[model samples]
Every structure is written in C-alpha cells, then in structure tokens.
Target: MNWRMTRYTYWMVLAVLSFGPEAAGATWHVDDSNTSAPWTGADWDNPFQYLQDALDAATAGDTIKVAQGTYHPDDATQNHTEGDRSETFLMQSGVVIQGGYIGYDNESPPPDTRDWELY
Candidate 1:
C-alpha cells in the first residue's frame, strides 16, 4: 500500500529485466553418453558416466568434455539441432566445450588429456 515500497519493487523488477539471456552464465555439457550407447571413456580415461547429466547440471560458461559419441535426444537431450556436428559439442553462452576427436570416434586421446575447459 506504500508508494515507497512500490517504487522499490519496481526497481528490482527493472534490474532483473535489464540483463538479457547473456546476463549470466549458462552452459550445457554432453559428455556422458554421446549417442546414447554409453561413454566410450577410451580417451577420456575417467568417464563421468553421465553426459546428459553433466550438461543438465552445467550453467553458462561450463564446458562439457565430449570425448566421442552420438548424444541424441533419446538419451535425454531435447535441445539438439541439426547444426550440431557429430564430434563438436554444443557451446552455449560463454560455454567452451572441448573434445578429443570430432569425427574419428576411435581416435586416441591426447597424452595429457586432462579435460575440457569452461569459461
């Protein structure tokens, strides 16, 4: 009922609306089951066991280390598009997904393949 309180509330709403989708970080990682067959973990070494899970948990700028696989929607990925490449992982706002091999699923991992980096 107070005008002062209404003014404050209006400012708060304005603040949140000022920033667009690029305001905060929001990244999605698809490293677990690339094609829904299960992470090869060949080059990954220590596979996370849940690619979609990781992606779901990731926010902006988080990089999902996709080793090698086909992450289809059947595996819980509903945001995939035709632009998505087989090897290239989806990068979102500030997201920096990395991969060992993009095409060659059987390619050997790097000697010091630690993991993908995020923003």
Candidate 2:
C-alpha cells in the first residue's frame, strides 16, 4: 500500500473502532444527598440516591451524571458513614461517569460552575 493509502486505512480503522457498537445512550443522574424516594434515575428531577444504583441501572453506552458530594462504596445508602470503608466499584465498558453537578435541577444554560469532591 502507498503511504497515503496506509494513513487513510489507519484513520478509518481508528474511527470504526472508536465509534463502533458503543454509541452514546441515555443519561442517568445520581444525587447521593437527595432525600426523595421512588428513585428512577432517569433525570435530575428523579435522580438515584446512590452512585452504585445509577451504575447498576446504566448500560454500556449510558452516561451517569453524579452530583457534587462525597461518596462511599461501602455505604449502600450513600450516606456518610464513619470507619474504614473499602469497596470496589465495577464500571462497565463504554459507560461514562461524570460528576461536578451543583444541583439536581437541570437549568437551561447551565451555570459554568461545578463543585465535586471525592473522599
């Protein structure tokens, strides 16, 4: 293959691999401090309380949007528990986990501000 042909083939392969079967899907929300019940995790209005819950409900191409707060894997309730809590979070491939949401409400023209902290 010529130099140009090789370069074109390489880019085509890369594009196919990157945007192949894994495409952007639904977006789920998680607010650990949210006291509301009947969590659906569909949107910010009805967000899940725990990050794990969101992850569990997410698919390969889904995106999980987490609100600003400290989360502990050992705490199923997503509350602040004192002790040496150690747990692993199993993430699925092609799933995106984004944080730094200021509130549960999805405001139009979202404020250019975020407050995310991990403990």
Candidate 3:
C-alpha cells in the first residue's frame, strides 16, 4: 500500500487495539435486594439477586452495574477458599464493575438517585 494508506491502516489498527473488545459491550444490572424472578441481570427492571450471577452472565467488555447492598462472594454460589486471594470475587478481564443504585421499582431510577457505597 501507499505510505498514506499504510499510515491510515496502522492508526485504525491501533484504535481497535486500544479500545479492545469491551468497547462495544452491554451493561448488566445486579440487585441482591431485588425480588425479581428468573433473574437474568439483563436490565434494571429484572436484575439478578447476586453479583456473581451478573458476573457469570457478563462477557468481556461488558459492565456489571450493582445496586447498593452487602455482597458476599459465597452468596452468589461462588466457591471460595479461605485464604485464596486470587479466587476471591475475581472479575473477568476487561469487565467493568459499577455499584451504588437506588433500585427504584416499576420506573427507571434517575441518575441523581444513584449512590456509591463500599462493600
């Protein structure tokens, strides 16, 4: 290819690599306090009850948005070793974890209603 074409292609490749696969991923919702059935964590209206459920349903580049609540790694049916730090709630590579949700029912919660808390 010509120099200009080669440069353009190089830049395109760089952009793709920099963004990675997660750039176009979807957002998943998790609310342990939610009583929604058939928990799929697909949307805020029907969120999974456990963080691990959302994580299991998520893929690389996807974001897991969790509601405010205490989450125990074991509560999600995750196998945990007492002292295995590496296995403790280890998130998928490239996945993003966001928390602090007011979890309003029936209607979508406003952005301002969302709050952050440490688990």
Tell me each candidate's TM-score.
Answer: 0.34, 0.62, 0.63
Q: In model 3, what is the error at residue 118, expressed in angstroms? A: 10
Clashing pairs in 2: none
Q: Tens-digit lDDT track for model 2 on 28-82? A: 9887767778688887778888777787788888988888777766545453353
Worst 10 residues of 2 by lDDT: 110-119
- Cα lDDT tens digits for candidate 3, 10-116: 99999999988644798888877787586777777778887877777788889888877777665664455434445556578879988777663535455225667
> What's the distance in Å from true for residue 104, model 2?
1.2
lDDT: worst 10-residue window of model 3: 104-113
lDDT of each: 0.48, 0.73, 0.72
Cα RMSDs, all models: 10.2, 7.2, 6.0
After the best TM-score superposition of candidate 1, give how far the Cα of residue 42 lies from its true spot, in angstroms: 16
For model 1, residues 33-86, the per-residue Cα lDDT tens digits are: 334444433334434444544555566656556644555433433454444445
Who is ahead in TM-score, 2 or 3? 3
